[model samples]
Target: MRVEDSPLIDFIREEHRFSFGTFYFFDNFIISEINEGELFDWNKASEVIRVGQEFYGEEGQINYISNRIHDYAIKPQDWLRFLYERQLFKTFAVVTYRKTAIYNLVIERFFYKGDIFSFDSLLEAVNFIREQNALEPANDFDKLTQLYNDNSL
Candidate 1:
């Protein structure tokens, strides 16, 4: 299914312009897919935090999933700010197919203070979160996988 066609999109608020990527927000987590070659820094990070507050309210703690679908860079200095906003996230997950992205994740692990998990697919990421939070597993996992495979290229 196309992103526009996925029912999942209906529950997710999209914050795309400010961060130079597609950010999908659910009640408890945010999934961010970095735009190709985008430089994610303090300015964009601030917008993300602001948007998260708007979606989840000021006191809510959210999980985060980085869908590393494209190559990008994160400013190391901005990690300090991320540390401050660390309260906003209960856990962090990354899904990537690239070895280079895995290397980047290792570097990120040093700066981020939370449980971090890596997965090969979005479905696995979602399942991990569900398990962590004691939420029901997705009943249509196969359909979701097919939807992603069909539309994600």
Candidate 2:
């Protein structure tokens, strides 16, 4: 499951876990910035899923793994099925920190969740996503779902 050399990823950082450079959300996007400690189990992911519901409503079921998250700790195939079956995040973000194998697992399984991006700049990713979503005009469930499917981005 090692990510041999990512063409998709831009850079790598051993410090501060991982981070996003920027992301533009055409709809209500659930961006979770994961730290090394958070990736241990389903609890954190589940919590984020709940918040995403509040943020995006029923359609705000997408899950974006923020920064950290060593892929070795979680089984993404099972995780995706779990989320989809339970009607949690329809989409998700998969990221890597220092390990290639862990990253490989995430990328292979969670690609369909959103527009995948990689970054060594964890703060940059957080800032970018935050700023991008800041102007999203509150969480509009109706428009969000339609836009999610329609945009096909």
Candidate 3:
């Protein structure tokens, strides 16, 4: 299928969302945006990312996507599945929102502190992913964080 055959996810709030811009899967080392605050489920997001990258015709899309951005509300179950499915986890700097402790509860309730990242954007939020910029209160995270943080505004 052609890139145009895919769907666009302009918004992913409380559930996963995917937006189809001109971004061909293979266009860059990174794949696409992973919005947080939208239902936090690893399998679901991974599946979406994989299907979206199907047109790119590359298998490394998972690794590329994983390396791209902050994970909003990932859980310990999600973490386990992520690790067991891929065997070894990607070295991407995955993160979740600090202000909302819902998913963080799941993370800490099940896994160790080192297994996940907790930040308020003022802490250690990444300044960029794939070299894209970020904004505050998540100023150090990806620009998508800017979007997620500003969605309600």
Candidate 4:
């Protein structure tokens, strides 16, 4: 499904725009749409993380969904920065139909150790998140925190 037609659109808690992209914060997930040709690096990642922390708290377990509605370049290595900083997401989902983006996702998997998935439509990604969320405990912050502490240090 298109981003505008997403099932979670009505549930967005807050919407924020940045020079590089737009972030739609939901109750337990974020849908990000970066601008075309923008280079997404650690600085951009930090901005998103800060907003997520502010909206969901430092210990909140949230999923991140990248709605690649535009062509963009991302530094896959920046996942290391997030790991080093102890900022983690429950899962990462990407919605893309582009071949280049699919190749990039493969490269990203080498650096990002967490669970990541890709979908051809926004609705598919959203459904995958819902399924994953259902399998997880309602309060999995402690589990995430412990995992971070154990692996990040």
Candidate 5:
């Protein structure tokens, strides 16, 4: 079912479909659901990040959630790209019921520096993000500068 048909419609502010996945953008975060058996490489990951930049611009500090409702795999090299570009997200959350996915997330967390959380369902992940977002300042100049490194000035 599309996000609009699902309960997420209320929480999602916008949605975009890419070549390999769909992005559900929320007020303070985004959820990406990759297509089944999709091969996520550095190029694809870059495209996704680019879309996020366009949607939120350089000033937004958004949390990210990967809703792994369908099976997919990322290229090994993409891990380095993800690690290097971790600043694209304030926190990373992965949702999956599959054991293998959970194991992979555990391994990924070892190399990821920022906060990473795993959940068995999308609702749980969104709830956690909402709670975290509530605690964060709406527009703290220092926090924004530190997170986004606003070098435009």
Candidate 6:
């Protein structure tokens, strides 16, 4: 379900709209809905990071959710730049049912330094984020792998 249709909207503490997309900031996570047909590259990613810091502060550890409600082109390789800049996230979740998005996610995994989770539903993604305990390391590789394997996302 789209974020707007989910109860998630009630939790959004701040919202930012750009030409490329909209960002919904919550207590523990931020949901991004990029515009259709837009190219999501490093330049656009910079804006996201800047605004996110404005809300959550630079030291905050918030999970990320790419709520892909519309078709868009993303530079999966830009993840390298994201990592190179030393930015980190507790978890990165993608909400998309498209086969192509899943395939692209596979490519993104190679560049992303942290684990990425995929879910067909927005609620599932939010639940997964909520389950994460931010005080501890989120490197429970086996458990995380099992969860994704079970979902086949």
- List ranges where model 3 is wrong by over 4 Å: 1-16, 19-38, 52-75, 87-89, 94-98, 101-153
RMSD of each: 5.2, 12.1, 10.8, 9.0, 8.5, 7.9
Q: For candidate 1, lDDT tens digit of each residue in 3-89? A: 334455655655555548878876557888878898899888888888778777888578888888888988877886778755677
Q: How close to the true structure is residue 99 of candidate 2, measured as C-alpha lDDT?
A: 66
Residues 28-105, candidate 4: write the lDDT tens digits. 678999998999999988888888888988885778889988888878777787778774778889998788888878
Best by TM-score: 6
Clashes of each: 0, 11, 8, 0, 0, 0
For model 4 the local lDDT of residue 82 reads 71
Clashing pairs in 1: none
Q: How close is every model to the real structure, measured as TM-score?
A: 0.81, 0.41, 0.37, 0.81, 0.77, 0.82
C-alpha lDDT values of all predictions? 0.73, 0.40, 0.37, 0.75, 0.71, 0.76
* lDDT computed for candidate 3: 0.37
Off by over 4 Å in 4: 5-7, 135-153
Q: Summarize candidate 5's per-residue lDDT along 38-98 as a digit string, tens digits.
A: 9878888888778788888967577888887777877766677777766667878898768
Candidate maximizing lDDT:
6
Clash pairs detected, candidate 3: 9-18, 9-19, 14-39, 15-39, 126-140, 135-138, 135-139, 136-139
Error of 2 at 78 (Å): 2.5
Off by over 4 Å in 1: 1-7, 13-16, 139-153
Score candidate 1 by TM-score against the native.
0.81
Q: TM-score winner between 1 and 2, please give it.
A: 1
Candidate 6 — number of clashing residue pairs? 0
Report the error of model 2 at residue 143, Å: 29
Model 5 residue 126 distance off true place after TM-score fit, in angstroms = 1.0
